[model samples]
Target: MDGVTIIDHPLVQHKLTIMRSKDTSTASFRRLLREISTLLCYEVTRDLELTMETIETPLMEIQAPKLEGKKLVFASILRAGNGLLEGMLDLVPSARVAHIGVYRDHETLEAIEYYFKAPEDVVNRLVIVVDPMLATGNSSIASIDKLKERGARNIRFLCLLAAPEGIRNFQEAHPDVPIYTASVDSHLNEKGYIVPGLGDAGDRMYGTK
Candidate 1:
C-alpha cells in the first residue's frame, strides 16, 4: 500500500474484474488486457521530466515543454509482457523495446532464461520492465539481473497483477526499483501460480491452454 502502487482506477479495476471472470471470452480477455495496460501506463510515465522551449502557436509565441533525456526502453518479460507492451506503446510510441524470455522448470520451479535482447543504448534510457503476473518474482529478478549486466540500472517494473511473495522477493533482491501493479492478490498456490489469478497469462493471451 505504501511502497507499491495499487491502481484501482474505475476503468482499470473494472477491466481487471472482467479479466478475472471465467465467463469472459478469450477475445474479451485479450481486449481487456490491452485496455488495462493503456490505463496503467498513464500513471507509470506521468513523472517524466520536461524542458522548456519557445514555440509559435497559431495565436502567438508560446513556451512548450518537451520531455528530457533518452526515451524509455520498455522491457517485456517474454510472452505475458508482450500483452502489456502494446498498451504501454500506445502511451509512449517512441520508446524502444526489449524482450526477455524465461520459463520455469515444472519440477524444480526455478526460472531459466531462454533469450534476451536489449536496446543498444539501454544504459542511457529508462527501463520499464513489464510482466502481466508477478508470481514468485524469480523471472523478474532474473531479468533485471540480465538487464543490469547489459548496462540498464534505472529500472521500474509494471505488472497487471502481483502476489505478496513475489513483491517481497523482488524488493529484497532489488530495493532500488519500484514496482507498479493493478492488484496484489492473496498468495501463490501450490503450483506456483497466483491464487485466483486470471490463470496462465501466456496461454490466455494466445489461446494455447
Candidate 2:
C-alpha cells in the first residue's frame, strides 16, 4: 500500500457499489464507470504542476494558474482501459492519448502485446495508464514497460479495482509508478479474478462473455 492511493469520495464509493451489483444493466454500468472515472482522475492528477499565466476576464487582466509543461498523456491499456479513458478525457480534453493493446494469456496470465501507439514526445510528459481492473498486473506492467521503453519517465497507473496480489506484483515490477484505485479488493480468485470484484470489467461494460 506504500505506493497506492484509494479514491474514497462518497460519490465514487456509491457508484462503485452499483457497478458491483450483477443486477446492474450494461448501460447503467458503463454510465457509472464513466462518472467514477472522472472522480478518480481528479485524485490522480491532484499534484500536477501549475504555472501562472496572464488572462483577461471581462473587466480586467489577471494571472491565472495553468497546467505546466507538455500536455499529459493518458495511456489506456486496450479495450477495458478505454472506459476509464473516455471519462478522463471528458475532464482533460486537451490531454494526449496513447493506446497500448495488451491482453492476458488465460493459461499463464502473461501479458501479450498486439498493438501500441503513443505520442513521440512521451519522454517529457507525464503518462497515466488506465485500466478497469488490476487483477494479475500483467497487462498493466507490460503496458508501462512499453511506455518506458519509449522513454517515459514520469508515469502513473489508474484502475477501478485492484487485488492485493496484483498490487504487490505491480509494485515489485514497477515501484516508481504510483497506483490509484477505488478499492483494493480482498484477493484474487483461482481464475485470476478479484474476489468480491464486479466480475470481468470488459465483459460487463460491453455485455460480452
Q: Could you report the Cα RMSD, in angstroms, for every candidate shown? A: 1.0, 0.7
Candidate of highest lDDT: 2
Which candidate achieves the best TM-score against the true structure? 2
TM-score of each: 0.97, 0.98
lDDT of 2 by residue, 31-63 (tens): 999999999999999999999999999999999
Global lDDT scores for all candidate models = 0.90, 0.95
Steric collisions counted per model:
0, 0
What digit string (tens of lDDT, one per residue) describes model 1 on residues 1-209? 54688888899988998898878888888888988999988988889999999999999998899999999999999888999999889888999999999877877778899999999888899999999989999999999999999998899999988999999999998988899999999999998999888898878888888
Residue 104 of model 1, lDDT score: 78
Query: After superposing candidate 2, which stretches have Cα over 4 Å from the reference?
Result: none
